[model samples]
Target: MAPPQPKAAAKAPAAPKSRVKKAKLGKARNYDLGNGIVRFSKTKMFHKTAKYKFVGKKNPKAPKTKKATIAVKPIGGEKNGGTRTVLLRRRKSFYPTQDKIKTHRHHKCFRKHERNIRPNLTVGTVCILLAGRHAGKRVVLVGVLPSGLLLVTGPFAFNSCPLRRIPQRYVIGTSTKIDLSDFKLPAHLNDAYFKKNKKSAKRSVKRKEGEDIFATKKEKYVPSEQRKTDQKLVDEAVIKAVGKREDKKVLRGYLKAAFGLRSSQFPHRLRF
Candidate 1:
């Protein structure tokens, strides 16, 4: 078997073409240089040169309307030692249409007429316990609930009493008064040496140079003159080239120069 030198292995056959037809060629690709950068992709750029077309001849000079003339009223001085002395008059509203007028008299609830009937429950009003185990015990009506329930602040036995337990003694009276005029803080709690423990906190985020906090986020109306000729193409290229790899420094440079992002600004992750 060694006598015959090993013959060179036969080369593999090339792939055969399928019967499926190829796609037809479309329009030729258009290209342009944009924003001082070489852009290989194509894009249509346009600009507005004129306003609306006039239907009639242009009028350069036109007559102006005359200004209105009116007399000024004289001021009146006060007579009763800087006191106001003017007759007040109530005016009726004039309705232009008959449909707006109503036939029925409307009753109004005047807020000024509403009186504070809540009894003088100032820090002590002797009230009787109406319900519960201590139904007869007298309690001080410390406060009154909007729902007509009285807050009777008294002994621990009556403190646990519900609104139903509030009796005639718990009834709001002016007799029971707690003198708070000479009340003072206890000696043990009056320590000026007490101080709060300090802990290091995170620094607040600082905004970029040209940012306004209260400014409404408006749709950026890019003028035709200010817009880059091939911005879309450039952005598409950048996105495609920078796919997957997220180098913070490189991204910072590109974003700062191209999109006006500040380097010291906080980093935000880009979503796909």
Candidate 2:
């Protein structure tokens, strides 16, 4: 403490770093070899081989293009002492003229007209109708009509739906199927058979001399006898087929029940 500390030695300054000069990169150059030929060098001093020579001749002159000129005629002759150029008007056509003739070839259709039925849908399969007058009603699939429409029935006893045609796109195929292999469909059960007969013009009944038109009774509409017989025949066959199965009661109840979705029911998650 008593001895005064010697002055600290001054710190020596750091030596400066040596600056290095970067080498300049060389550029390629072209060397003329006479007779319209030239060779390119790989670098400023490195020349390529003779095989790398290219022709350096001037390009040939392009041919002159023809200019379109408009046809003009002098009007009023020379009597007026002045010439007025009038351009010839071209004949205008409503339809465009085609330079090339095209043959009338029939258009080829690439679309498929016939629809593929779902693997789950088959004859005698119980399906839920999704659209049309009988939507939500479960009906039995009879057979596919020639027009690609599905023929179905409610046996006319359970849901009151008679033999009718429905498009396959409007039905949801279920897992339930009835055995109708042994059952034969009547020959008249087809698309044409379902067509309604055109009704004749109704003739006005000769009203009594003072009869009131408002008091006249109207005729109630009734199904044709042929239709009733057809429905009975189809329903009998279906009921007979149902009777053959052990779960006939359950199947009948299922067909009679209407299809519906609950709050938690998701159609996509449903198997059928």
Candidate 3:
């Protein structure tokens, strides 16, 4: 028996309700096209009209703005030289944001404002080591050098900041400032001070005569024995300044929090 002929699918027009739900609606910006002709478009961005010019009876006179002028020195006379007035050209800046302006010296427009990345590099500033074998290590700012250099230390036994002068560019400065109120370290802290202090500290370690029987003969310390001693002294001052424990791990957490860094960001003991 022949099966009933397949029924043809009926075509149904889209309903108005379905079409309304599927359509997208957005407010478009109105642009001045002159001559009362208004255009509505999604491609055009909305902007407020520029400064209004008052010429009606409500406010008859237009306000006058003062002109800007700057003093300029003659060529090759920057140091101890007389200056002359240079009139600046006033123009309407179409830039929406100040960041769009370029920064340059000796030009019509000068951008004096700059970001000071290392501004927090003051005395007792705790920092994170950014490079070398000790990358990610923490250090405390104990002394500042006159040449804008930093004298930092890790209290080596704790964080490995050796007593050395490093350039400010190397370490990452944190807003967390440490205290050095009672620290009487000399302005010029050198390797000699560390060597001498370490030696004195080793001699101060008291040991009984019979204590050496089982003890292996200690090899001469290469700034090793004194490091612990210096660490103690450094830690004491640091603890006083920061009012918080100077544990390396704790400071690592501080660095992570201050910079909003992830644990995977700085690899521990990274040679880089």
What lDDT would each prediction earn against the true structure? 0.40, 0.80, 0.60
Per-residue CA lDDT of model 1 for 1-272, tens digit only, reads 45988889999998897789889988434333566443332122221212234435687988889554443344567653544334344345785665766776334445324334345554334444545665545444434333334444333322333222232333424343433323222232211212222532333345667876554443433334212332232233333433434563463233232112356764243211
Candidate 3 matches the true fold with a TM-score of: 0.36
lDDT of 3 by residue, 1-272 (tens): 99899988998987666434556775545755778555743323222432233324384588889655664646555584555656566557686665567865442332333324365677787777766666676777887654445677775546545676667777877666666767877533564443343334223334568676444444354666555566567667765554454665565455333222567776454432
Question: Quick one: best TM-score, which candidate?
Answer: 2
Off by over 4 Å in 2: 1-115, 199-221
C-alpha TM-score for every candidate: 0.20, 0.53, 0.36
C-alpha displacement of 145 in model 3, angstroms?
2.1
Q: Which ten contiguous residues of candidate 2 have the minimum total lDDT? A: 43-52
Candidate 1: lDDT of 268?
49
- State the number of backbone clashes in model 1: 11
Clashes of each: 11, 0, 2
Best by lDDT: 2
- Give the lDDT ranking, best first: 2, 3, 1
